[model samples]
Target: MIGVLIFPDFQILDASGPISVFEIAGRYAKSPASIRLIAAEPGPVRSSSGVEMLARKFGSPSAITTLVIAGGDGVEAAARNPCTLSFVRAVAKRGTRVASVCSGTFILAEAGLLDGRRATTHWVRTRQFLATYPAVKLEPDQIFVRDGSIWSSAGITAGIDLALAMVAEDHGEEIVQKTARQLVLYHRRSGGQSQFSSLLELKAPTGRFGPLLTWAREHLGTRLTVADLADRAGMSARHFTRAFVAETGTTPSKAIERLRIEVARSRVQSSSEAIERVAEATGFRDPERMRRAFIRAFGQPPQSLRRSARAG
Candidate 1:
């Protein structure tokens, strides 16, 4: 049985997304998989979105093949609960495949289930999570990570991706493909894909600089410097540099490089454009420079990523 653990103020999609994947996969499998919603306290549990779900007591059936913990605003409190931590620890000790969605990793960490293990959480919580759990090998850039029996994912929808991977493991690629089709997901994103999209990361700045970042994306083929961006934003170079960093959590050069990489990667993966042309079009005039940037950003060169994309 696949069991999803929920607590008060848990994110609704964190549980439901994975549940849907499992449910759909079960339909196409020879033997259907059983699913259950569980909680420390058995009853109607309110989600962070204000939706309520009926959850069975955690120990009601006493056995589960896989146990997924949902994450949300209440994770800090849930992490502190002795009952919740103990329950997670006990289940993991029994060799059950244990996983956490987004902030739910805090609960597993508190229970000492993720100590010295490679794990990932929502990208937004990367810094705090690293500072809090110094023992965990946190890969904040990954969409999901699996270490031994413990699994973790980046954010809400990533839980669905993690679930699809689990289904693929238990069933097969064909089963997961069918499940993905039913769910209308474009494709099952690989775990190695980045958590941060170039456009999304740049649009993170909510201030006056937000529109400027969008403009930068549109003109990636040209050289973009702090001075150039400052002129566009109508600010002095020094002030623009400080403001850009303050608003975007990144320097102007880094932001430009990210934008270029995004466009370059998209072209590489989706088009038959030559690597040199892609580099020039994305403002990395030097093919070698683009290769290095790709290596830095994705742990692989452009050609390698292109090959992997094609193979997939």
Candidate 2:
């Protein structure tokens, strides 16, 4: 059985994302592994987003073969708690295969479970992690790191990638591909795949141009010219240019390209659609144009990113 122990104020995806992958793996594996959600307590646990989930609490480590401790804000305080730290130490003593997601590293390191082990956590939390757990060898660049049976992931979304790798380890390549397809996720994102997508969070501009930015996201497929956008917003080109830059950190042309890159990243992960087809659908005139835009934003051609998704 593969067991995950979640704590209070856990990141939602830190639990849900990995489960989505393993649930599919359970169906296709030669010998299905049981997946369980174990919490520190039996009652409802609140997530970072205020979503609540009821979980089975295990005060002691069970006979489960694989154990994962998920991360969140409650982790810092939990790591310091005698009960939580003792529970973690006991689990490690049983030779359980232990792993952590994002900030969950705190609890494991606190219990001395990660001493001299290669691990990772959310990139934004690296400084705190280093300060708290100096014995662990923390690698900031990886999406996930595995040293022997102990595994750790960088952040919430990366947990899914780590879970897929675990599935691959248990069932082999074909089963991992099937699971990825079922979950609509990447097969094996290289541990190096980035945590941030500046394009995905492309913040909408405010003030008079706010509505215009919304209109643009809705109309990315059209041949949108600055003149056309200005006309739609009922502003002169000169005034709109200054205001647009002030509102969004980018210009009109760059924003459209960034939006398109975000769309392309999703398509590459979820579909076997041809690159050229994706380029056209997302408003690129041709593959070359898309290549230029992709390189400027992602530092690699679109195909390279797609290749990383399939790299084991």
Candidate 3:
């Protein structure tokens, strides 16, 4: 049985999205799966969005094969509750697959399930999560992460991705593909995809440098330099570099590479363009240089990503 643990003011989608995927997968599976909404204090638990879910009191941990904790404004409280933490710890010790959605990771971390484990959470909480759980290896860029039997995901929608991945694991790629099609999702996104799109990352600041970023994105085919960007921003090279880093939390060169990767990746996945052509168009004039950049950014080459995208 899959037990989704919830508390007051939990994110509604975090629980329902996964539940829907599992429910659909159960229908097509050889053996149907059972699911339940569980909570420390059973009753009508209100979600952050004002939707309420009827939850039963968590009873026997042994009956649960999978335990997913949902996250929201009440996570801090859930993490502090002895009943919730102890339940999670006991279930994990019994070898149940433990998982979390969004800030639900905080609860698992508090229960010591995430200690020395590679995990991820919503990108918005990356800084706070890192500061709080320095022992956990956090991959902030991933849409989801699986380490052993533990799984974690980014935000509400990513929970659906996580559940789809679990379905793929339990059933098969074909089952997940069908499930994705049924849900109208274009494809099941690989966990390696960045949490932020290139445009979203560049949309950080609307300050003086914002226009410069826009110009750089448009001129990706050209050799953009610090001096060029500084000239556009009407600042000296040295001053612009420091100010750009301060505003965007990344160096100008790194930002440019990220922009190129984003555009290149989109073209590679969505178009039938050759790798060399895509690389040149994205400002990585050399195909080999683009391959190295793809490796650094995604832990795989452009060809691998394209293959996966097509296969999905």
TM-score for model 2? Answer: 0.63
Q: List the residue pairs that clash in candidate 2.
A: none
Q: Which segments of model 1 are wrong by more than 4 Å?
A: 60-62, 190-257, 263-275, 280-312
What is the full ranking by TM-score, best candidate first? Answer: 3, 1, 2
> Which consecutive 10 residues in model 2 have the weakest lDDT in total?
191-200
lDDT score, candidate 1: 0.84
For candidate 3, the lDDT comes to: 0.84
Tell me how far the alpha carbon of residue 241 in candidate 3 is from the true structure, in angstroms, after superposition: 17
Q: What TM value does model 1 have?
A: 0.71
lDDT (10s digit) by residue, model 2, range 1-312: 777777788887888887778778888885656778877677888888899877887745766778778898888777877877777777777887788888887888888878999888776676577666767887665778898877898878888888888888888999999989887766765324232522225455455556776677777778888888879878898777645543442355656666677777778667789999988888886989888777765667888888888783
| Prediction 3 TM-score vs. true | 0.73
Clashing residue pairs, backbone N/CA/C < 3 A, model 1? none
Estimated TM-score per prediction?
Answer: 0.71, 0.63, 0.73
RMSD (CA, Å), each prediction? 7.8, 11.7, 7.0
TM-score comparison, 2 vs 3, better candidate? 3
